[model samples]
Target: MILPEIKREGERYFLSSFKLPDKLTFAGQPIPLDNWQVRERIEYEFYQFLEDQGESIILAKRTGRCFPPAEKQLADAGLPDDLKYMLLVESKCVAAAYSKAKASGPWQFIPSTGRRYRLKSDAVRDDRRNLEMSTEAAVKYLRYLKDFEQNDWFMAMASYNAGEERVRRLLKDQNITDYWKMHGPRETMRYVPRIIAAKEIYSQPEKYLGLSKKDLYMPMETETVTVNVKDSKRALASIAEEFGTYFLELKMLNPEFKKDVLPRGTYQMKVPRQTCPSRCFKQDKTP
Candidate 1:
């Protein structure tokens, strides 16, 4: 077997001589590589991943940790397990991620789209940063898009980055159904390909990014607590202290607390797991 080759200059080592995998699919839908453009676009995405090896490696490390809940939710919904890669491509697994377009959270939902998916985002609270809620909303949106696009997952994915109307227009006006064959805005064009490339690299981190299984960051299980706040920050602090976790650490767990406070009204949030050493550390008296 001929292994992929790598070469190093004084400053940089480049990955090359790696043939594209014999087969690539996204969301259980086979990528139509028979089309030269489809093959090129997907291969272009592969090289793009290789080009940002450091960042891609970091994202790969994170994917293991971030993907479990997504996989679980999709599995529960009977959706494709591979859709988790789309989350990674969207925000690199950062729950509090924000884009200049005002898209927020791990799923990178803009306000209107977030609202369409029943995600609330405002000055006081943004469920977009709530990992579980955002993932659930995204799954619903993707499911709807796929169904709208006649069960073509890639087209649905492109529709996600673009929008349903634009995708519909392209499909109708261009007299074509294939994403690779249609002309879309640059960002939308690159979206699904990036997702596909991410799935490939993350699935074979050892082969692609040279990361070992042990190096992968897996999700840390956490417990949830529902707390209601009315008085002030003191109320939340008290809850955190009771859980044997610091307020700052609690905020890390729940970034939806834009001001270190819970969303208005009844909302259940993940607090701290006393069983987990990392989550249940003693508070510093000095502070």
Candidate 2:
């Protein structure tokens, strides 16, 4: 999609006549657009997103493949549909995504956070890299934060970017009730506005960036099978050979397994059901 360009002068770039929508809502709650500070912050991020159209296109394309299942999961978990954009904002919906701070996966859970939420990260497996597991962990954490923040989704989202206790302390100490009003770290300050701008562009790609829903990449038709295995690596190789798929295909589909060996217990595997051969059966009996 061709994105709008920013014009520049001798010292600084500008979107001179560009302006944000008259009103905006995030996660079913209205952003206080009457506040010039709120409008300026969100507009700044929108300009930033426009400045990186190449990367934004990549993110939008990925959303096609990464969004559906997680969208369903979010709906099932009773989260607002717009919150799905958090995955995009967090890690660009990349399962292999890793940040400099050691946050990993689409949900960007740091090691300690992953452990607290039962997302195991070890030599053999980092559930933080697993889409399903990490997504559940994110939702669980969001829900907990929501409750703690007195059902305010904005506060929960801010705490997600910043530390929960830090935000809480700021809120209490400053006697501030609004997330936008509370002072926090730099990243936390920009986090919500970034997500809001992303959601706007993503949902209306054609309007904003000359791209349609057809440009999105949805997941392929696949099914998950439960199988008991002794060795992860060897078992995957065997399964790949049996199904006429590469080890990487299965590996990509199941990002939780970090080691070469598949574990001994029952594990769920996603396979392309239609394209897989009839002999591509679930492996309940291990050799």
Candidate 3:
């Protein structure tokens, strides 16, 4: 099988050859590759993702850990499975990703939007940094956009990148509902295609990434538990000790917490299976 041409020069890698397939689809809608402008737009995004192998490879590794849950959420929400790629384009699956716009988490939701979606933020917790919570919010938000865009997934995705009001105004001004024909902000124009680019390259990673199964980063298997912190002054290190885990491991498992000290709340946490006894842990079935 022929692969996308890749060449390494010193420390950098370049994609020397890439061809647009005759057909491509995003969120179950067929991409108009026959249109020269659309083809070029797609090519631009392809290069944006593939030209640097380091970022591309890191993204591929992250996809393994991040995509499955989001994909499942999309499926459950009855949305297109391909919609998960939006997260990849939004934050490259970085849980701690924070934008200058203050969009946080792999879903890249700003504080106001995050709160609107029921992703609460407090001194002790930011649900935007919690992968599961943020993904759930993203699914609901996309569903709303999909309905608002009159079931057009492309326009829905565009609305996700650009505000819905702007997309609505663009549709009214341009008198077109077609995402391809309607002109919008430059970044908004590129956003959907970037997501499509991620889908294409990641769907068959070996074609672009040349990575084996072992090369990908797998999600850690852990059991979810409910921990009640009765003392506001108790540090996470103390809690970690109670669970037979180190403070760092505890923090790594629950990235939502903003501080090392507990704030007297009932919190759900994840830990290695068998690390804590059943009496000490309350199994959470919330997924």
lDDT of 3 by residue, 1-287 (tens): 33345653444444655666889987778999998889889888998787777889999988888888987988899988998888788888888889898888889999988999999998778899999999999999998998898999999988988889999999999898789998888989999889888899988888787887678888887788777878756798877766656789888878888898987778788876663344243333222
Q: List the residue pairs that clash in candidate 3.
A: none
- TM-score of every model versus the real structure: 0.86, 0.85, 0.89
Q: Which 10-residue span in candidate 1 carries the lowest summed lDDT?
A: 1-10
What's the candidate order when arranged by decreasing TM-score? 3, 1, 2
Instruction: Write candidate 2's Cα lDDT for 1-287 as tens digits.
Output: 44455433444334444457898998889999899898889988887776676887788888888877678888988988888889888998889898999999989999999999998888767889888788888888988998888888888999898878999898899998998897878899999999998888788777655578888887876787665676533567776655545688878887877765676677677766644244344442233
Best by TM-score: 3
List residue ranges in candidate 3 displaced over 4 A. 1-14, 275-287
Instruction: Indicate which candidate wins on lDDT.
Output: 3
**Model 1 per-residue lDDT tens digits across residues 1-287:** 33234543444444665567768878778887777877788788888777776788898898877888898999999999888988787888998899899999999999998998898876767899988889999989988997898998888888889889988998899999777788989899888888888788788988877788789887665677666665543455766786777677777788876765543466566765556454453452323
- Tell me the spans in candidate 1 whose CA falls farther than 4 Å from its real position: 1-13, 232-239, 261-267, 276-287
Steric clash pairs (candidate 1): none
Count of clashing pairs, candidate 1: 0
